[model samples]
Target: MADPTLSRRHLFQASAGLAAALLPARAQAKARLGDDGLYTEDWYVDSFLDLPEDFAAARGKGRGFALQWSQRGCIYCKELHTAYFADPAIETPIREAFDIVHLDLFGAREVTFLDGARLTEKALGQRERIRATPTFQFFAEVDGKPKEVARMPGLLPRPEFSALFRYVAEGAYAREPFDAWLGKQGKG
Candidate 1:
């Protein structure tokens, strides 16, 4: 017994509005370009450039930890934000699975590395061999200590990118390479 005055279109609009209201406020908003000339989402981790501490915090939250290396004037980095991250299907799960600390690949911001060495972000990037913009270096507990477990050196297509997050968060890397894991999932 539907109300004759309440048309399906009105009902649909009401439902959509309710859904939007129920979502986290930030979830409905788009990613923003920061003053540093990088695009940042509300969900990205706000860190103090202490790599080891940040990793511990991420682990405390039952999440993976990663460094997102990007430079100011990189087009691929922009696309990673504007295109891939703009889609909730790709961004939501990533937001859920990891605490991402953004770093400038060429900036002089001081960062404390896991080995207790404090160095500029640029120097650390060089030490880690992060030569390009938009590299993701994921870390996890390895042999009872925090160590880099996997790395994505550049932007990946949406599907593979999402799968890469899963590969780390689910501890699938210890079982197999990403390609083999993806192949088993029928997305390779």
Candidate 2:
């Protein structure tokens, strides 16, 4: 009794409308950037590696968060931000798992170290030989001194980075090299 042709057309239109409605949400979900805007001055990136003076003095309070020092106008740095940190695949775990401090690698802002010495982020980077932009340092306090346990430069693929994070979070550095541990993770 009904008009089949008109009914099919109407059905197609409804389906198309539903797909259109979901388009924006799907795009947004894929590009879920943090409010930080990828390391612009608007928001500070987190560096969980830095330890407070008192914490450093204790020397063995277990591992804390890592530190990330970055500056504006660096291409590789921006890539690291957008391709790695900003990606929802990585950001959520990092936020939940560590304490992060964002340092302006070029700004005049001052940071006090574990030894009670203070310096600008640029100076600290220089001392640490971070000639490369976006150096990720895994830090720990040993014998009342700040120590860098691992230094990874540039952008890493999500899976590799996630494995490295897992290794560090588990304190595997206490007994083995990160690369060796990473090999083990990849096998499984």
Candidate 3:
């Protein structure tokens, strides 16, 4: 007869070995932290926090302005960077279609609105009624001013996020609401 103790020991050892083998992969799935303890990416556009100028610049580059509002210690932001933005399929379209700028939800950095209003990043978020981290504000030029065309208030799944890039890039927001457009594309 087989020894029950030996069988249990073998099972435990195998489970431990499998977990050890998966450690690197689990680590790799985590987002890399910046000096400020927030996730960072090299391709995000560096700007002077001027919305009008940034919008014009993005248009000049054939892209829209994407303001990403985040806060430190936001797990959703980390997931957005690590899981969604890290995917080449999603990142490539976003990089091609939008000039992304990061804004801290509670930071004191100065920001100039398109209407010539100046406020701190935190104040701006308050003025905009942004109550959540990882909010994405997409803008397009409307009559020489940067107008907010769409807003994603929270983290979207990978497919929806990718579809968002496509919808904006294709100028579908001008014709219909994002939900309608998304539904038309069978991605809603």
Give the TM-score (vs. native) of candidate 2.
Answer: 0.65
Ranking by lDDT: 1, 3, 2
lDDT of each: 0.88, 0.61, 0.82
Ranking by TM-score: 1, 3, 2
User: On residues 23-72, what C-alpha lDDT tens digit does candidate 3 reach at each position?
Assistant: 66543554568777778667787789987788788899888788899999
**Candidate 2 lDDT by residue in tens digits, 14-39:** 99999999966533443223443335
Number of clashes recorded per candidate:
0, 11, 0
Question: Model 2 RMSD to the real structure?
Answer: 9.0
TM-score of each: 0.85, 0.65, 0.80
Scored by Cα lDDT, where does model 2 land?
Answer: 0.61
User: Ten-residue segment with the worst summed lDDT in candidate 1?
Assistant: 22-31
Whole-structure CA lDDT of model 1: 0.88
Runs in model 3 with CA error above 4 Å?
1-32, 186-188
Task: Identify the candidate with maximal lDDT.
Answer: 1
Candidate 1 C-alpha lDDT tens digits along 13-102:
999999888786544466689998888777788888888898899999999999899999899898888888877788888888899999
Alpha carbon deviation, residue 157, candidate 3 (Å): 1.4
Comparing 1 with 3 on TM-score, the higher-scoring candidate is 1
